[model samples]
Target: MKMSREQKYRLIEEAGEEELALLKQQVKQSPWRQKYHIQPSTGLLNDPNGFAYYQGEYHLFYQWFPLGTDHGMKYWYHLKSADLSDWQDCGIGIAPGDPQDSHGAYSGSGLEHEGQLYLMYTGNTRDNNWIRHPYQCMAVMNADGQITKWDQPVIREVPSGYTDHFRDPKVWRAGEQFYCVIGAQRENGTGSIVVYRSPDLAQWEWAGELSTSLTAFGYMWECPDYFEIDGQGVLLFCPQGLQPESDKYRNIYQSGYVIGDRMNMNTLELQHGEFHELDYGFDFYAPQTTEGADGQRIIIGWMGLPDIEYPTDQQGWAHCLTLPRELHLRNGKLLQKPVPALADRRGSKASFSGRFTGRQQVPDFAGEAYELICTYTAEDEQDHVPNEQSAVTAGQASVFGVELRTGENEKTVIGYDAQTQKLTLDRSAAGKPFAESYGTTRSCVLDQPLRQLHIFVDVSSVEIFVNEGEAVFTSRIFPSRGSQGIVFFAENGAVHLQAEKWDYL
Candidate 1:
């Protein structure tokens, strides 16, 4: 049930004590719950919020609705990780109750200044007529991880010519000034990103919207994050109402970034190049990034998509954060690699290699939680043989990468089509029917010959980094627990293959 203003705040405190207790019990019986990913102990979780390194630990907050599986009475549930691989839940960071955030504490970013940690979030409130009033609110966290909301919002009111869809303020310090970029919508129903500047983090000034090269990008943009990678200013945001292209933007919504050399603070405009999708997969959105203690930019995103029905809802919980990834700018393209710290979770290892023509199941290479690296040398397209079971057209693929999470009746396939130069991840037979809105097949075009596929498989999610992060796919799959088989196959031609597997400890 949707929560009103009063009921949300009242339930926030009362539900905290009771809901968490029952959550611990509900999770034990949910087979789809992740063992290593960050997830809500109960209810629904979405949009990673206020991710920053503070004091001696890394703090990550998420949009949580603890009462049930649906969105209701949003709160910020805080969790701290010393190494980004092991996390400790720290309970509710901010709850909606006060006038500023009476309806919900929406998405935002985090900052650690001096000795205190601060969070700037969009406070969602609704009038009796059901009109939304968004407030860019601020809060602080002590060394112990306890949070205190500021007395009032630092930035109030939606600027003229924009709807109340303005929210998800991402704050970062640049030079001597602090700036925030929030997603907004114009009255004409176009999406934009607006910047706000503050010298002391209290008073904020309108910094205008970033200029777009396209005439119409999307209707509304949500969860905007502005930051610099290397020397390029990266503006990452999720845009709604974009039509799908031949091989891109096939999801209901898309999250991506445009890279530019400089951001003009006066006009709040970014002179950027072409837009690129951050992750090409069935489920990924609302990604946030923070600089690590070692000066590396680390990012984490919700592993599930919006407006889709997940199989986990019946188990009483849904959604999780993708494994933390390190961002890099390589050859003008953004590259995402799973952080090396995750190696600490590795328990055992297995290796195999061979020449395969059709398909071969790798012995002892089956598990719901492990990291797999598959390398294949594709034969010449004209020399390759065709398999009747393959969906790819003739002369398109000489070698197939591999498939994981395979069962007697189901499998999730990740393969390379040489003719089309497309890399595909197909989950049509992964078990359990889902909403028709959720697409089962996702593909990414490759410029060079297929070489390597780095994959991470959790209980219910799969993240594939192709060609050392040249392209990446992050998706959530609901295969049965017994569907843990892995196989490598090539159609019409023989290809050399080497596979390595590491199970999480």
Candidate 2:
């Protein structure tokens, strides 16, 4: 059912106690509730916002619509964690009834200054004519965890050349000055990023549109994040209205990044390379990153996409945040590995090691919420010359992988094809189906030989890190509760394999 405008914009306070209680009951009854990932208790969650480490803890926020399970009247829902494995919910961090954020509080980033964390975000307001007017807003949080929004917007009106689509201000400090990059669209209908300069968090000045090679990319660019890793600059953003080209941009909206030399502060120009997707899966968007206390760059993405109706909507909640990943720049590509701290949540362990030729199932490896690590190596053959025919024969057996959440008539397959040199995730028969038009299988070509698979499976989602994060696939699946089987298979020939599984505590 489509939500009416009034229903969509209703404030949480306007809801009666019975209505709120019923919503909570519906969410608790949902079978798809996440085991370890950060999901809303009620209503909708999207776009990780204001992620930063401050005052001996990690502060993370997301755009939340608490009244229902649709994108309506977003508030900044807060969570804090001493370790990334466990999160403490802090309720609504920023409500949206003020004049600036009359409609909603949108996405942005967080920066820690002297003894405080500064949150810079987009305040979304709609006028009587139903047109958007976005404001670059600011709020400050003390070490005591109290937050206060400024009485006025830091950046008031949209600049001259861009449309009202300007939003998502990501602020960073360079040398003695603070800089911000905002997602924008030109009057000519092309997507771009704009820059703003501020010495303090309050007063700001428009520098100019960021100069990049991408002149006409998409219709709108949202959630722009800028950071430097190992002296290389990376700009991450979600560009909407992209048409599918080969295996790229397969989703309705795409979240990706471009790496290059650091931006020229004076000219605001970025000399960068091509855009590469952060995750290749059915559900990933609006990823936000923050540097840990030890200077490790870590990221968390919304585990669902925009404009897609998920099966969890009927349960009164939708979407979750991906497990936090540690980012590394290796050989000109960003490699993402699940944070090492996650090992703290590991429970009972299981292991299997052998030369397997066909399908094999380990009894202890089946579970709903667990982590699995498997490594495969081709067995060597003496006196057998490596030729095209021999390679073809080997490829047949090399086309091996695992099936997860298997039941009588459903399973999700994560397999690698040596012949095609591709890693594929197929959820066609996984469970209750939605978004079939977008296809069920997503595959990525591997530049190197496949050696390992590190997988994390929750109640309703999966995150696969292939070959030590050379490529990653993150997706949400809706399988029946009885589907708790894990099977491993190889075709035509024997291969050496070692595997381990650990249930999440």
- Tens-place lDDT digits, model 2, residues 203-304: 899899889898889999998889999998999999988899988888889999999999999999999999999999999999999999899999999999
Q: In model 1, where do residues sit more than 4 Å from their true spots?
A: 1-10, 14-26, 378-397
Q: How many residue pairs clash in model 1?
A: 5
Q: Write model 1 residue lDDT over 115-190, tens digit each, in one string.
A: 8888999998888888889999999988867788999999998999899999999999888899998999999999
What lDDT does model 2 reach? 0.90
TM-score: model 1 vs. ground truth? 0.93
- Cα lDDT, model 1, residue 245: 88
Clashes of each: 5, 0
Q: Clash pairs of candidate 1? A: 384-492, 385-492, 385-493, 386-492, 396-419
Each model's RMSD to truth, in Å?
A: 4.0, 2.7
Candidate 2 residue pairs in backbone clash: none
What's model 2's lDDT at 42?
94
- Segments of candidate 2 deviating more than 4 angstroms: 382-396
Error of 1 at 94 (Å): 1.2
